[model samples]
Target: MAGRIKDHLSIDCNDEGAYYVEARVNHPLREFLNHTDSSYVSQLLPAGATWTATTAGGYIAMIQVTTFACGGISLGAFLSHIIFDGPAATTFISSWAALTRKCGEEAGSPNFDASFVFPQSVAYPREATLSALFSPFLKKGICRSMRIVFDALAIDLLKVKTASSSVRDPTRVEVVSALLCKCIMATFKAKSGIQKSTLITHAVNLRQRAVPQFSKHSMGNFLCMAAALVRANKTGLDNLVCHLRKAIRKIDIDLITALQGDGGWLKYCECIKEIGKASHGTNDKIDLIVFSSWCNMGVYEIDFGWGKPTWVACAPKTKSKIEMVNMIFLMDSKMGNGIEAWVYLEEQHMAMLEQNQELLAFGILEQSPLNLIVS
Candidate 1:
């Protein structure tokens, strides 16, 4: 069923289905998959079905299935960020596949209405300025996205490198994000010939953090931002991990309660303000790097009647979603223990980053999905 948007952001559930497309390509999937150029990946994704506040009654989800000459298929889905965050999108895909397989037990019924806890009025105030809310990192620019794979061995080494008395055991996401941030900071310094203060924001899932916690199956944008700052000189991995851990720890029960309160928007505004303040106060240029982890979201487990996907991927660099500079999206690799980071930056910095020995030591840059063996 399609969700029709009413005035004040209310959704009217109707029988109309989501936007879907199916196409056949004469070329085999291996031709594009094995190709060195990553642009071929975008051909499998559906386009021209985006949602905006003004686009009333627009479909909340868009799906495309492209079949190759070799009989291999590519299933691509694009969920509206308005109502679906990473976890919500994963749940939607999994449930859709379960229904296709006639597995009623695996299907999930998502809760579309979350207004009781997060009212529309406070969610987005008419007077709020988006520029101040996101500021430096929320602009369109020429970005180059590179796929970097960190095997389990690299992650274990990173954990050892980041370990300290304060943070005995750091997760894969933390160590990877820290190492990437360190490399990015170095890249910025090399480009500008001066060290710059960097602000790192990681997307935090609030579904399990909120008081009277919402179910994992609950829908809508249950996401919050956690900010960690790395000064120009203090670009150590341990320092970055410490700051990241502290900022993420701040998104506790109290913060979630405030986000769910009547003055929820105010609380959110304050959080953004705090982030802005934290990002400033330095004379040097501030570089904002955004990180979103889709690891352990069960995306690889999404199996239709055809069986599970051989490899899952984010959209190519041509997509506008990651056009903003310094965006890093981390996902669980096909092996389930490793991580694949989609790092987006400006072309020049990306060139330097791709050659960074420190980064390349821990990650394999632009690895082909076709050659990936999921054992």
Candidate 2:
């Protein structure tokens, strides 16, 4: 009976972000077997877990099981980016810890009915429509091989330097994004040797699309991105920041209102088609696609009566070729405030990033902890 799977449940924190937990028998590697009870499992979570909290949007956390030298007990949890975005994932993990401690409970029972919480039925159009929008761009084939790199201290330093500049506040998400955007733009320009107007499309979430007090806990992809134009000749960091801010701001209430109405989804599709047409098969119009470094891997609160996790990271399988740089942040260690970024890019562009090392710095991890542990 113990070996049988009991629950495969996903819970939304009080903040309305989603997380999943699964219980399984502990493997033979556990050393402290038969010593700890379920309550001990709960205590181990807060002590050993760490999270990379994002500033952009949702609550995201990555939980890792470092030492599982206990009984045959294990649990897993996942915080999806669609529901909590990035910022909310972090808040959910911290809040879950607080809630668990306050109740003096061992893994609080989760409210896991996605029908009521996410409600895929009434949320939007059918799956076909959503699939049409998200279908991978395979017409030309994936162009570049991707590699992920992380340089915690180096990225932080860049943030500090960019913040000191007069153009924009030195916030972690914005400044880092701006820097990465510039890096990619430079790489494309240097490699392709074509200088035309280009744009960096920033994916913006539309959670407050129609509903003002829209519950952050809603589980779905209520998100969209706006392209911030950058001239091929623009070289300065401030210019990138200014255009990014403007592009982000442009996707305001009017844009959301226009997109969410009846048949709005189709209109949105047409808009993308139009842009694709405008690009005219040239890298001039929108050369780079960039998103903030954020993901929610429920690391801190997933306690399955084992010791806390020692390492956690994003899955390496998640690769991109639309742009040279795609980044996501992870917690440095348990009980640490610093974050490490995993950047995916092509080898050629990566060399350029290294050449301009003063502007950007990164180190490749041996392997992605997420892929290692989860898969």
Candidate 3:
């Protein structure tokens, strides 16, 4: 019933090297679907971290569609970030979902033209390079995560509080990213040698931002990083949101084009390396936070003929989700208009942040409710 999806994906990644497929029979769907610790991750996942692919088949991509005893279906896919970015992955998932709906030729085509526009001529050692950028803040630390859900009312109130007459309205992403950064930093304020500056890096969509623009169906890594640095005594996250708003707006097509031009990668890398290193993590350190917004990517819109997902959660594996310290993902709330912040922090940091009254005021903490499955 998953018409042309297998073929669609293969063609999408054809130039990336050999692709392999795998199918596995796993646990029943209800156990995974109904499981929970206050939220979804704890309920659905078995103990310890499990890879999206475990068959030891050297496949660049792996996918599975499992039918539940209750007549519901679950679709899972795994892809290395080196080959795809958030937008690219979203396009693929949406396309796959549309196909299953039998949306036909109108079910549509994806544009893998991102790479043709932004060539990967630079041989970036993906993991190593990222670790270098993430290390000072996250390396060798035990990371912990918990789901924090903001209700529609809290989100609306925050939008009002975060806005200023001086600055344009703060976006949902800017508001939430600012909130997490400020709250997390406040948790560490008493620590010795803590820096007063904070940096926020956001993953941006290049489809509409690219010159002349690319279709929403455009695939591959059409992504770039935008960093906002909050320096010394940034009174409130609301204030920081203004700075962040400006930084994100600066990421236009001219910038993307230049970053992709001749010697573009080198210049781009250098600017970023400096951004990470220049803070001079000396005795006085700077606080850094990275966030990506998946709020409107239509993850919950996925329906494999068993009704829309009751809940949509990122794959919160230890290696993939928790290992990246101080990283935050802002996604659409299962509830109508709010946002869910999947916060990954050092255990020590999480403890304090969880108790922050200011945060508690605006964001309700939803610890996963535990569930036992008879697997």
Candidate 4:
């Protein structure tokens, strides 16, 4: 599938077959699972799975199956974000698992008419405008990726620490995301010796936010980008959570309806402009971190008749260091309530972030997934 961005965004299905690869590792599975380095785990995925246009030799989906010396198997799937969102990918995997297990899975058909619902107009922000607006995120640099797990206990304590009359009962994602933002802000200041205002943008799933709520099986990019600003002095957990909550709430039914209306493109451009404004024009004095939460998306529940997975993970952005920097992918931990954050940051900032005492106080860095299992 190719995403052609001209007058509007449209996906062209070229009937290109999905890419698949099988590999074997000489090392034991336990050896691989014991480490949290993304580069190491990335070996399980098919190399060069990055999505490109069909003419550019890109595949809409890429699959890799790797076997370890100890007979353990790992499955890696890379789906194009242009064509599928988290919920859509989850539905696809679940149905595939059910079919593999011969369970007669009846995963409902997917809805691919998002463009029809939120049709793009001449008012839509052109690719150039978007590129300029989000250029900071598109910069290349020496980036490091790692996973940090926030267990239930830590999350509960965070809720308490961040609880206020104005902000109470913060969701797991909210609290965790806030903490990460706060820590990253501090890390950046310490590294650069200059406190910078931070921009926190979250990818909100539109399936449940829309007025009619798109089905879970709907395909295409059905998401809303919500962002908030945290001044250098207001990076407190409670304050950050408030900002996050408010930004996310702005994507509610009213906003969704507006985005689908005739002036939808203009509304989207306005939102993007507002988000950019939150960072005060994106100079060195401003930091940007993008978050995509896949929590509660049933990622860990995928099974191919071999029982539930011991762990599920998102591959880091190592393959293309130029693509994403200061990004976080949040997914459910094995215990279900906890969140495992897959963070990507510049090398210098990551070196400091990994050693942040305040962050380490509430989160476990690089813990093995096998240890989460209860025998």
Candidate 5:
């Protein structure tokens, strides 16, 4: 399955932070088989495919790049995690693109060098315990689900907010993620009426764990979870922002400790299981799971010389009942700070959230425009 999916190339780009660039290619199944060649792009292309790129302000741009000889169209999309959390499955797109371009240059050269990746051997203490405690959830098919809903009106409001702000902080990615976390937490508490049961989970990368002198290029899943406890009935956007800032600050410590060859991963899994069990029994699960990352930072840096990607976004392959959201920074040719966020939730829950006009005012919500590409 991995081999089949790694056959295509994808690229992301941006122009002065104004917009994002996205490009993808698809080949007929017969053509693919006949080529008998490996390229980063080819490796990333599944048998049948589709693709899309979402931008900030609730705009979705996409392409069904090619129809495979096998009688199916290749599909793809660029999803922003604000709609779910973290980059989700969109990381595969960039990785695939990198691999494809590399293969194009050196037919047999390995596209990715996993030697620098934090070995599972070093991550064992935590993984072992987590596997023992929460393997059941994985066995029962633990999956993640995400939806990218675009809202024109809300996006307009976001523009207004960005324009009104005078701070020169370039951390727009962190700002948006923080805001989403605040809104989601407020909504969860309001609906559940459990003021005291509020917590937020954030993922942190740990490439600098064992070797502080190591270069920053090391990739793969070198990450850990950070949790924050929120006070009940925390209203107002400013208050929420304050809380988010503090939560983000706490991530550094939590992440380092968790990645120190400790059993932190197990503890994290146990915490999640406890939350799940609590949600099943009393309806009070973690208030919100906020996922955010600066994936767009890698957008322009990745290109196959097809100009640059018009947009970049994220899409998750699985769905879960958990309350989660993700945010991503997208680039477009237009001016101003444009960020795109994807949201997924049950209709009832979403409708109830709509009642909070202030939060809803930030961005518009539209049905996800991306199609799921299942292998």
Candidate 6:
């Protein structure tokens, strides 16, 4: 493998291994892998990704470019999650695109000094302890991913429905999250015949939440979780939004400083442990749903000299213990006006969630025209 071979390679090998496959498509790219059913795209990803082959680690990341007979092309990336979160990962992709066209500002160095936020006195909990607490979610659930699209009209209508004198008005992310929260709660209630206390957690970006906001170039995971607890009967969208808003507003610099340095882990562990033990007696189990919005993360804007991506998504093989905790990743739609929610749920509840009337009313996948061209 010579560096000069980067332009293109012609390899002659018997098709007995997994790294490459030369295949033919019998239909249009969109029809074969429809936008409405994005889950199908995840199934074909493992072979298409360039996996890290060894610890010698020559590649921190791998890129796969696939061409279809209908002239459609798809770009996929396999990034090390240990090193990059959603925003950081998108930054890398965008920088590559900018370099391809030579049209963007010079890239700046990333900030890795975490001491700028947390003091040496602050201590984080042991990773093993945190993992043990959430192990219950990882042990027995079968995870499934489903893509839900909310066009611009549906988003506006949700805002209208959620606006009221009693209920606090919400942002697109808030209202949408609240709507999904209720849908899941309703599904659980209908299945169990009893209401249960549940938690909703959203991953909030800490860069903008800081006192003197951190630069966008600052790297590493700078995310804090904002959580709200909703009791059995108060699972209404309005109630959820209100609780969620309060939780988010409470994530000030004081909370960030405390959570990072001042015995935060000890208190958090005790709280979660006590909640779990207390719930064992009431015949009501706790359900946690986590949402992370990547709405303006610039992932959809990666052009790479071919064209902007028609669809961008995280491959399912990248799924980890986090999915078992029930998570949703909300991304900006290709059109830039709506949201696309990639929801990962336990297999048993997926059917019920898809059929959720209120969710269906808002999230209906709309197909976009694809342009097929060359590099």
Query: Which candidate number has the best lDDT?
Result: 1
lDDT of 6 at 37: 49
Local error of candidate 5 at 343, Å?
1.5
Model 6: pairs clashing at backbone N, Cα or C within 3 Å: 122-261
| Model 5 residue 309 distance off true place after TM-score fit, in angstroms | 1.8
Full candidate order by lDDT, most accurate first: 1, 4, 3, 6, 2, 5
Error of 6 at 4 (Å): 24
Write down the lDDT of every candidate, Cα atoms only: 0.80, 0.45, 0.63, 0.79, 0.40, 0.63
All candidates' TM-scores? 0.91, 0.56, 0.79, 0.90, 0.53, 0.76
Q: Which of the numbered candidates is closest to the native, going by highest TM-score?
A: 1
Ranked candidates, highest TM-score first: 1, 4, 3, 6, 2, 5
**What is the lDDT for 132 in model 4?**
48
Please list the Cα RMSD from the true structure of every candidate, rounded to 1 decimal place: 2.8, 10.6, 6.1, 2.9, 12.6, 7.9
Position 167, candidate 4: lDDT? 82
> What TM-score does candidate 6 reach?
0.76
Please write out the lDDT profile of model 6 over residues 256-284, one tens digit for every residue.
55655446555445544643444343544
Clashes of each: 0, 25, 9, 0, 69, 1
lDDT, residue 39, model 4: 64
Error of 4 at 304 (Å): 1.8
- Which candidate would rank higher by lDDT, 1 or 5? 1
Q: Kindly give the stretch of ten consecutive residues in candidate 2 with the minimal lDDT sum.
A: 1-10
lDDT for each residue of candidate 3 in 275-324, tens digit (9 for 90 to 100)? 66744567646667778888787777766556777666665544334347
Superior by lDDT: candidate 3 or candidate 6? 3
Model 4: runs farther than 4 Å from truth?
Answer: 1-11, 51-55, 104-106, 120-136, 280-283, 318-320
